[model samples]
Target chain A: MRGKHIKTVMVGGIFLCATPIMAAEGKLLATAGLSQLEGSGGGGLVPWATLAGYDSRDETTALLFMTDVNITDYRLSSIGVATSFYDRVELSYAQQTFGLPVGLVKQLSVGEIKQNVIGAKVRLYGDVVYSTYPQLSIGLQHKQLDDDSVATALGAKDDSGTDFYVAATKVHLGAVAGYNLVWNVTARATKANEMGLLGYGGPDNNGYQMMMEVSVGLLLSPNWVVGMEYRQKPNNLSSVKEDDWTDLFVSYMPNKNINFTAAYADLGTVATQKDQKGVYLSMTGYLW
Target chain B: MVNHLKTALLMMSVLLVACATPTKTPISLYEEIGGQPTIEAITDNFIDEISFNKDIYRYFEKTNITRFREKFIEHLCVDTGGPCTYTGDTMLKVHQGQKITETDFNLTVDLLVNAMKKAGLTYVQQNRVLKVLAPMRGEMLYK
Candidate 1:
């Protein structure tokens, strides 16, 4: 019962993809100062997906970096950066760390579940300077799992692998209000045993699995942004497993050098469990 | 060798013809623009376009438009070789911390062209204005 409920929540997790906000809907949302937190094939947080907003810059090329944290019993964190060339083409990279503090992740523990992701993105349409077409981009993410010690500890085959995803993004222009949307589909080698940790779950055959995500954001002011995201993952990998989370967040940018964010997240449990909820406060710094 | 000599004579004849031609009176594009009167006429149109506009300098009103109009014409005429003197300070000195953005600048460009139209300037005359002011982009932007 708990596993099914968690699975249901996964669909909503798509909107909770990336919550880096501040100015997401405006003449500026499409043309923010830096894309460190925004600008993708889809909204922020969709791995290897494209976005609606093109790289809209007119002066010396632009660069941006952002980091978000989820505060709860199970620690999770995400960091990202995006840079544009000639205001048309763009490139980005990100890393996500889940199950932080490892609880008891002794380097000796075999088959310990840890997920690290690296990604790149490119913008292919809509001129950053003057164009009527909605800006578009494409992306790819490489998800890697370290399973050496964990393999021996579990007496099973190593559970490390990768996941691929594609996405699209769009921005709506208006006289009073602005909005942005991003969506994507993820493909994986197998279901059940992928990025989740067994150290956290008692006896679930959780393995590398496939999933999908969709994220969106709205700008309330020139300097403030609010957003929500939800993700769906495979939960049938084992007898004891749960999936899905919903995230609501807000971000503020005082200048080109810094962005501050706060968020509320819902992390479902693995075995006969309850919804694990928490808040995260994080600060991001940009170099160059 | 005879053919080569004939070719050299032909080339020299063309060169001599080109050099002997007298230089026509060079007309200063600024003077052809009708000097201060031309700038003043365009300034009036730009003021109407910008003063009534809500995007840039929306805070200024009809009276403010007249005052700014007078100042701008004086400035443009002086800068473009018209017989006018401008006492205004530097552009950066005037717009410091005004929060002026590129959107506002583009809109101003639209208004300027609209004003020139009202002043009966032809496309060539309009381009003459831009050819001078466009190069000042570095001085007018960023701050």
Candidate 2:
């Protein structure tokens, strides 16, 4: 069933990519970062406040993105769509599938974990570029795990929950040796375990915990960016110790309507699995 | 590591000596952006862009293009620390009856950025010029 859903989403993505192309209007090129895993505008792993796409207050911008991750013992894929309105408000939705190794699937009596996420973000103050102040935004994500039987067996307390975060992003043009620099800091209050794939909360801790995430990117040119991100997670589940996640990524925007990103991610451990390092690839298409 | 440290110390001493030598003159923003010729070229491109942009051209319809261009060039030249005098009207005075919206102001800025790009200014130079101009948005908008 999960495989079928993944295939359907992939087909939908391809269809969207084939839609009639229109020139992206407003703001300069590459000001809006690529969509992150959770469908927010950001780097691969961390969310930034800048809206996706270059459209400003006069226009609306839409984006479709698909990401695939190959880990040592597992595979994860996410398909998402996001829209930015007037460069001030954003709405996004994403579906994620976590595939376990065949041996682990048999041992745990679980085939795969599927999750759906809906997110909304509002720009509160400042501008990401062309201003000295750091742009601030507040975002909320509602996650629901489709298969909670494995999560319950692993001592998860809930199958669904909401995560709230406040993010600040600032861009410094020509800050470092003629290269632009972008800095982001986010604080999240979440109860999700492993981004809610294993479910929300647990036996050890059922309350929401605050987490910190930071990311920095250097613009190698107007079209290329290299960055690193660190996201801290809570160890709420006693059954499995959760560690922080980090990634180093490079993104290239060849034009206004398309961009590609590749990254090396260290997801730490999941369940009993250790050293879950992996490679990630994502492609994004923009529509105006 | 030791070689790196020695290199760092040597560079620090060289910088210190350079700083102690007081005869070096500070370059103004105007000089850094080239002189009258570069500023004039940028102004011409900016005017061309504004004229072509339907969103902003309507605002300039009743005004004198040639005179406005000269005033704008003079304004930029003086604002960038050049040896030119700006005898134009104050920002608030000139834009008082226009009642420009934020969107209009931002559109103008975008056009200006494009003009700078067309004038062959680097991103750093463009940003430096924008820093001096962005603050005027408050005076130019909603009045």
Number of the top TM-score candidate? 2
Q: Weakest 10 consecutive residues, lDDT, candidate 2 chain A?
A: A172-181
- Candidate 1, superposed: residue stretches over 4 Å from native: A1-44, A47-68, A79-82, A87-96, A99-115, A127-134, A147-160, A175-210, A270-274, A282-288, B1-143
What TM-score does model 2 achieve against the real structure? 0.85
Per-residue alpha-carbon lDDT of candidate 2 for residues A113-229, written as tens digits (9 for 90 to 100): 889999899989887876668989999989999989878877889999999999999876555543567778889999999998888999889999998887777777768888777
TM-score of each: 0.47, 0.85
Sorted into a CAPRI-style docking class, model 1 comes out as incorrect
Candidate 1: residue A53 lDDT (0-100) = 27
- B30-140, model 1: which lDDT tens digit per residue? 576776677788887787777688866553533455567778887787666677677776767655656565545545765786788788775555545654565454455
Which candidate tops DockQ?
2
Each prediction's DockQ against the real complex: 0.01, 0.17
Worst 10 residues of 1 chain A by lDDT: A174-183
Please give the lDDT score at residue A171 for candidate 2. 77
